[model samples]
Target chain A: MKFSFPKKVMAAALCVAAFAGSAQAAEKVYRLKMAETWQSNFPIFGDTPRNMAAMAEKMSNGRLKITIDSANKHKAAFGVFDMVRSGQYDMGHSASYYWKGKVPNTLYFTTMPFGMTAPEQYAWFYHGGGQELMDKVYNKFNLMSFPGGNTGNQMGGWFQKEINSLEDLKGLKMRIPGFAGEVLAELGAKPTNIAPGELYTALERRTIDALEWVGPSLDLRMGFHQIAPYYYTGWHEPGTELQFLVNKRTWDRLPEDLQEILRVAMRTAAYDMYIQSYHASAENLEKMLTEYPNVQVKDFPADVIKAMQDANSKLLAEKAAADPLAKEILDSQAEYMKKARHWTDVSDKAYLNNFNAE
Target chain B: MKFSFPKKVMAAALCVAAFAGSAQAAEKVYRLKMAETWQSNFPIFGDTPRNMAAMAEKMSNGRLKITIDSANKHKAAFGVFDMVRSGQYDMGHSASYYWKGKVPNTLYFTTMPFGMTAPEQYAWFYHGGGQELMDKVYNKFNLMSFPGGNTGNQMGGWFQKEINSLEDLKGLKMRIPGFAGEVLAELGAKPTNIAPGELYTALERRTIDALEWVGPSLDLRMGFHQIAPYYYTGWHEPGTELQFLVNKRTWDRLPEDLQEILRVAMRTAAYDMYIQSYHASAENLEKMLTEYPNVQVKDFPADVIKAMQDANSKLLAEKAAADPLAKEILDSQAEYMKKARHWTDVSDKAYLNNFNAE
Candidate 1:
């Protein structure tokens, strides 16, 4: 039998349906895909993106879901920038310097040779115009880049022999990559890029005389300490921060609440990784010393450090002269670093030196 | 005109009502009130809780709302712990050391006299056992404490006369509070607590010989550089971290999603505050130098530093001997700092010294 409700009752039913439909929309699940540069189960590097995604998902109460595809699944370790930029993936976890060849300005967003430390660089990024400069460079490419994680102060390299003077570095063959490699090349060192998988073999078999990997966090697993006797302290890539890249369109489409969740998740993950790296480095360094007594930690001598510094300065000057944007970024970093380093010198540096002497 | 044989339609309407009811429940708003130990508009200290509240609200889509009442409104600067404990307030933002009188173990959560720097302390808190120890302390009072923010490295103080020897500290009336003051008192320094508003007048009029406030981040407005010639570097409170206390009941009432949101928001805000403090200190220090050119930055003489270190060590030993829990927390920090400081020594310290010498 054909039956219809009264007008008031029908209006009330329609209102209820509208309310339920809107509520369902509010609870709609948004699934995003991310591509990371590291392979599956990679220690610190791989965990950063997963940590971020998990926080975002949990905070959003399953309404926001992010699935990550590692280099193993994507088969493109250095293709993170392109993948995220082209929207093939909604986001990417990689280092900004990895894309320097394609976009030269991307180099500065990651750590630089002889630049600010982690806290200093973070101040620059969040408060001293570094993020704006980063946005200026990445916005043109339809990508948003963020500081993903830090490897604290990276070790310079695992040297088979101590770098005592400039003469020692003249003919050295090392597996150092990116702008740092360029700096070494200027100082007459034969800098080369070898695959990560072959780094230990390369160093052990004398194919490469020395190689700079990450610090104790990721280095212990590679067995660099066992093969190389002299573990040089960091010079290049002091505070090596990884990058988080999101396609601009993907970011724009997110709801305000989810956007806040994603922003905070990435930030906390970045900070957490720095502390994690610090903890791991401390733990592993102790282990290396205890297990392998022959491993010697050395700093590059004054003259050699000076030579590298000069070479780095020359290279940076050339880059600044070549591009206005590069000039702006370099100048901003140098100015910020000057003030920040001054504070650091008087605070942590002085306190450490004074307390240690006591 | 009575409706008949419409049982199916009635059942459908009832189902819609149930859906709407459940949806409304899901959208329920959770309001929280926080009492802060700082006055309204207190720069870095006040900004932290507000930043946290804003992030939590946005991330929760307004479902989680936190309203903060400053000390001016609450009129109980030191009542934050008790307020949150008794459920008078849902949360609190204050320094952990402020509650040491009420709960002695609470002092360790803030910075110590000679302790780890910001990053080192953060590593100890998250990766080491600091957070667990803090939980153990706070959980007993039916509260949960989290790291609220960091003021970076605190300045030693603005001194009217330079302290070059331990003898200079004798009968020195200084406005330094908490455990550091106790350590100073052990060294024959007359340590006293002065109200914040009277600090400048006290120091300026020679009522107090030296006063240790925060670093340049909060020091610029006080005009201490103009009044005091010697701006000594930080020794005590290397990384003064503020604390966030949540009532156990308040935390338990939050939904899982809201809890996650709140957790991440506070973590990010704490990190942000550190960067902000670093940036402000850098900017303000530069301004201080340019404006007040006579302000001399000095480090405590080595002998004096040694004396202070011994005094601090002795005081700490007494505390550890007295309380088992205090011993556990202090021992955890000492062990963690040993390893972390070694890494710091070889990493950031080595890098900074090497680069600067270049």
Candidate 2:
């Protein structure tokens, strides 16, 4: 279904012109509808789609309204992609990683376990032409996506027992998702994607051997530490990103003025969200240790990191062989990384090497 | 004048446990110098002070050390009542509202005439606020301060012109400062209290029929906008806050951690200073204009807003009837204003606001 933007011309040129012409307009109101991934009444921090809807409504002076529908209320969790593509909703906020089947190249956009770090990923997407490629992929499905937010360098899942080696991954039923799950599957682990509301219950029922969510802020909110004692860090998915997908038809219909306003508002929200996340993490980290002293926190073994890294490369090659689009994205990202690595080495790393120590 | 940080115990038990009882063994890098305000540079868009400096030196592996000088650079600007009360620093980023005295309250904070709009004031402060305020108010007694920052809020300056009654502000300079000289004193005017930088210039050029400075951000910044435009939005002070003076003695002895890290690294450089401000004003406003073009963007008319708000009687009576400290400050402010008005509001108004608005 072609997503129809009800405001103006559907073509891209109209959108660009609207932005330049925005400064000279009479007062008008806009309402933005959204279909969220996180179910209502389920308290999950940084629940991508929900936060997007919430922030947009507030900043837009109530003139731009966003009606959010959680995944559970819409259909199955994964149904979000098809619904949005069919123009069932104006936008869909969810993890790209979850819809890897629908959009194979989206894995890199989400989390690839041992994929790129957060700062590197944002830099690439915003400036290194990665966003252009992703937009190319979305154009086919009638979607325009912006990076909603990120869960900076997550912690590894909570486990029933200590992971001693690669052998331990074998046959473990873990609630993991998307591309990361495939890599774990290769290691003989069974991967599952459970909605956040159902996660704690699954763990309580002993249905899964392990689960990984985000950092301390969300973990503390979710109370994962209470049910699972073996808390592990070095999550393969560092800087996990979420997507804000606007139905191409609806996005196209917005007046150029409204379009630019929405974009800037989103960017502002994205930047502020990170700041809020940082403070939340600092405060929550201290809270976790105090409330759950019995919970054991451990860093992932270096060898485990090595194993994942090795598997990631193999998986990338296999995907590239099968899908040309995947290969194109991978190739571009790889080139960007080569250049970015050198610059950041001198910039961020060098600075940290000097200061973040004893 | 070693600006000493008042030692306060940590609130968190864990932090206390980590640092307590090990004072002697603490790492003591050579102390350095911090140049300005709290949460100035670091805690926001730019690198935070503690982290920026720590990262810089941390990468050097302790080979280099830096210090921050907060609240203690020279004599406080305007009247830093709290700086002395709290003993926060040998220097401080201050505003006229705080002191309003030692100089006339109005002259101390408000800017004058068609002078020093936001951008211009920023330039003048760095170049002008430096040479003049430092020499006359600060260095006159051997102290120093630099321009912290400025927010633009000037209206063609609220005026009695719109009221069709410039006579309302007759013979009243209304305590304008900075460059509001020519415009304020123009219609039927006189300009006074002008600092060496501003004083001689206003008198010679014959600008500033009347003026004011800073409002919401700081009462000082808003002063000019309200008086001339007759736009009495208290929001004048909504965003005019600035930093100020440090005592030489205390600033020299501070340790590296608090000095350079928090101060020099805390504030953004002058040229790149308006990064966020530019975003808020230009980007957001541009977008808003498209949606809300009718937002009232006009100045105040003369008589309607310039009438005797009974500024002096209130200023004098309150100070005279109050405590010894209040009396001292009020008298100082009044003395300065008394001399300033004869030539300004009384003499200047005859030519300026009285005949305005063709």
Candidate 3:
């Protein structure tokens, strides 16, 4: 009987050990490939995306790994949207304004000339059913996306000539896209399409007289100061938004647990991108002035801005008449702007207007 | 005969129009879901994340869409990592520190006491080869990530007890996570793991006497002042980092075009979340003080802080010895810190320490 008990104990322990071994083998690790649209070291562009990838790796505990394919290693900046849509890869990164050609109505959801501020945009999207409407528009793209970031109102384009009057804008070939391009057309400046890669050549060769990318941080890296001496402010694209797009097929294949990880990781990245970019913009702008005295940061002429505003009103009306999709997005934007403007009048804008920037 | 010629011309024009119409369907809008990690209007957490989604939608002209599912409606904060990892959903929203159980090495990527600041972290990740290392680690988890957001060196956590000496921490129960908890243990304090929801309850019941959250802004939202009268600073979790995670399978399926959009979106969102959060943290803290008269905000005692520093050194060494992964991360961190510390001593610290907040 004692001999039997020892044998039984040995059998139980072996079984337990076998079970543990099987359990360990059953564990699976998921590897994710992420593509970022920004350059490797351009403050907001590179750092934020990289930080986000790191955030997910940490969060997953070696179970879910995300690697960011930086610039050049992947396609150029404008290639992000198409890449995510075709399911050629997995998660992607890019700005919404970058997709204006294929989806014109998307610009309303992105940045507009003197549109809503950060707080206002947040309120409308979260509560006013704006996020739902945005989703409605993205459904046709064959991919799913999450709003990952915003550049709190941007500086206007870099110009080769002084835009002293609305007349100067006539026939002026400028690299501007989306809604801003439409608004600029009304003011008589010809809004031209040019990708970031082609921007330098176009500007240097005088193929495009003006270009508006992002703020100083990214602008400095693109060598804007070297080509364009006249850099203007009064950001036409205010509170520009960016997003993370995942292929729908790929997204649907994941079990519910993994999907949640992507969403949170993207958000962490979005937030990180903004603050890093903002500080970088500040730092780069200072550097631009000191490092290169030839660069002139000028404010846009008020009259030209007024003319553009007039054009935007007319263009918006025309768009509402032509495309129903455009109309719905424009309507959402209008309604959101109304409430956002009211709130800002009381809070954000009020503080900024009252509080002097030290 | 002349009439036949005119008719032929009209027919040719009609044929061209028909061909153009066939190609006019542009890409379909793509929709995705972003599981929220916080309430819809939860200041830095909610507003920025939501706006990022909105920005992506607007910029994509509706070709890309994302539905923002607020925290709990989809999953709890802690659940975000698993949700994304298992591919239960496509995207996620959360912080890196939350997943300490999985990837201990990831903590270096997120936040640590007196470690790299936002800029330094970015540098280490991108320039110092930290990003690739992080990616390798994340790949083991079946996910890719981006830095979702950042709370600039977070405010020392809130504490009810005045920590004048290291002895005060003995047996003190604090709600802390990641390496910071280990440091606390080394210092003789008991670190407690508690969810954000249960935080107020635990403190109110004295189940946990002290809690360290993101910063003053988030602390105000939790109304920690009511339960903990004396709020102390937490130097340990300076610069808490959030993350957005994506499931690997879902990520690899995206086409190159959509990939660009998602990548830029993540970059944009990351940048925006940080600055907006910083601004919100400042405003909320000020508002909390004015609104709640009974609350007291105090910095950690010098001696107590010194002890925590000592604890950090020992804990780091122990971590390095036990886990190769932990050692790899820490070594990478220490390497980057060695280089960046010199600059921080001159630029970052000098500005903050000498500048006038007023």
Candidate 4:
């Protein structure tokens, strides 16, 4: 009698433990839908979410599934913030600054015209309280944001002509966007917003004289090299970081294990995407040189860069003065950059310069 | 058929379905022992493994447990390769160059003097066949290696006197280890290895005139600043990437889910440590300047840097001539760095210079 009762109890216990955290949880697949800003088959930007989802599913052994809808599918390229925050999609892949009009503080998370570079910005986010500030901004909207991937330093933009002085910038019809666009506008450049689909045509037709998309990784595919002869090195959006947005409710609904899986997958995918972008950009830049020999890679002259920098600083000062939270965020970034930039100068910067001095 | 019979059949079927792939395997814990190169309280280096283990355990829901044995316990700072290979320790946290004496090709996997920077080297590793090359070197040893963490760019060294010319390096008594030490030796510097605990005493008592430790992050704690005031910028070990060694047998035994969990955990931890090092370096560098105001951060003069570069190139050429695999690795790195450095120059380097120009 004792054996019979114990066997029954043991059988019931085994069933419960089996279904608890591990393989048994696979019986109920937790599927999440994500919206991304880029169109389907978009190079580095679109690949990030897909790579993340695949990792999460494989690591979780099919316990977690993420399905993505690109801009083509969703028909809302800049609406990722609203979609994820409102739970229209469980997550989103977009740049943080896209929602700057709605959340003015959101502008600072992505790269600034003269802010810290990629590694420095990442260091600031993980260790120097950038994540805390980001949380402060997104928590109100019931959203969580993480660094999606870095484009290294973005190109300044492609120009039909060289930007030699401040006069070269005045009324210059460039299709830059976000804070960089604002800075350009302050410097008297006519910065306009155009759909990415229309960027190549617009640039060719002189609807926009130049446009800053991304670096060589995504830029080569846009056919900008064929049309724009002067490809300028970056000043605006240096080390631009795309973002991953998750609805807090969606994140909370997962088991602890799945949550960790999703988090780690996203983190690895983000880092992977950065490396991928670097690789693609390197390869593409080489191709652009050999194939389109006339596409010159030039730096913005000293006077032009200085003018943009001055305009950037002035606009930042105005923004800092307008809002207390903005001031806090800006001050923190400035202080962090001051320290990090010094390290960069001593380390990589000096080492890179060694080649030139040779 | 009896109703009870059908119920039993249904329950058995459900059990089989629940325990199929993921959860059933996670029910058993995989405990691994890791040997680390640093001591128990070592800051950045020791923290990498702990961070990695914590992430692995949490993400696997306590399924994968990694316990580390520090140098105090293992008493083998340089014996990690053997420990992990012999299965005495299931894994190791150490630099790959430490094993170069036994396996000459292991030298290229870590860092090189005047080599690519952190981001560039990372791009090389993930995208440009680095992992494959690393596998070729480590596979025969029954070990698997991954980039554990990056120390960013290393400081050249702390000197009692300025390295103003090539003549200054002649017969200089320096306690610098690994490949960089060899390069210095080629330039007529007497490169020696000293115990970590005795480094400060060695530098202070004039036993060693100069010593290259890590950058500000780890060096500040070692009290190198007080002993030597002339802190030079990095050229040697431009991006010193520490390594994670896993015994192949141990890796092969884990279930698919646990394997994925461990891999992702290691990858994330590696990236996290790089950011942590960057943050620490920035903070410590700031503190060092405030506390030791007299300390001068100098770059080795153009002539001195040129000599070192020449020495490095000569040694690399010799290594390449000695072994076909070494030749392959060197050529791959050179080619990748050529492309990646161009991107870096046009991106971060250009942007960083803009600030200086201003």
Candidate 1 Cα errors over 4 Å, as ranges: A1-17, A20-22, B1-22
> What is candidate 2's CA lDDT for residue A294?
88
lDDT: the better of candidates 1 and 4: 1
Give the local distance difference test score of model 2: 0.49
Interface RMSD of each: 1.9, 31.8, 19.4, 2.3
- Report how closely model 1 matches the true complex, as a DockQ value: 0.69
Candidate 4 residue-wise lDDT, A1-358, digit = tens: 5674566557667866866744545446899999999989988888999999988988877778999999889999999999999999999999899899999999999889888888899999998899999999999999999999888888888999888788888899999877888888988899899978899999999988889988888888888999999999888887778899999999999988789888888888888887898899888898888889998888888887888889999999999999999999999999999999989988888888876687
Model 4 spans with C-alpha error above 4 angstroms: A1-27, B1-23
Q: Tens-digit lDDT track for model 2 on A1-358?
A: 2343332223333433443233112124566666767666644333444544554444333445777777667765577777778877777777777777766777778755545555456666765677798888887888887776665556777898888888888899999776778788887889998977799988877899999877675778778878888877644675667777888788777655346435644543443344344434544665777888887766545566567667878989998999898899898777766554433332223222221121
Q: Which of the two candidates, 1 or 2, achieves a greater DockQ against the reference?
A: 1
Lowest lDDT block of 10, candidate 3 chain A: A349-358
Candidate 3 lDDT, B1-358, residue by residue in tens: 5775565556555544433332122234566766767866677766655666665555343555777778658747568778878877678777776777776776666777767666567656655667687787788889787777666556557777777787888999998876788888987899988977899988888898788877665667788877777755446655556777777776676544345546656655665565565455545665776787777656566566667777788878898999887788888788766655443332223222221121
Per-residue accuracy of model 1 over A1-358 as CA lDDT, tens digit each: 2334575456566666766565665677889999999999999988899999999998988989999999999999999889999999999999999999999999999899999899999999999899999999999999999999999999998988778778888889999988899999988899999989999899999998999989998999999988999999899998889989999999999988888899899999999999899999999999988889999889899888888889999999999999999999999999999999998988889888888878
The better-scoring model by lDDT among 1 and 3 is 1
Residue-level lDDT tens digits of model 1 in B1-358: 3454356456567666756665665578999999999999999999999999999999988899999999999999999999999999999999999998999999999999889999999999999989999999999999999999999999999999989898999999999988899989988999999999999999999999999999999999988988999999888999999999999999999989899999999999999999999999999999999999989999999988888889999989999999999999999999999999999999999998888787
Candidate with top DockQ is: 1
Ranking by DockQ: 1, 4, 3, 2
Better of 1 and 3 by TM-score: 1
Clashes of each: 0, 139, 157, 2
Docking class of 2: incorrect
lDDT by residue for model 3 over A45-123, one digit each (tens)? 5655566666554433344576778667885667887877776667777777677678776656666665665445654
Cα displacement (angstroms), candidate 2, residue B195, comes to 28
Better of 2 and 4 by lDDT: 4
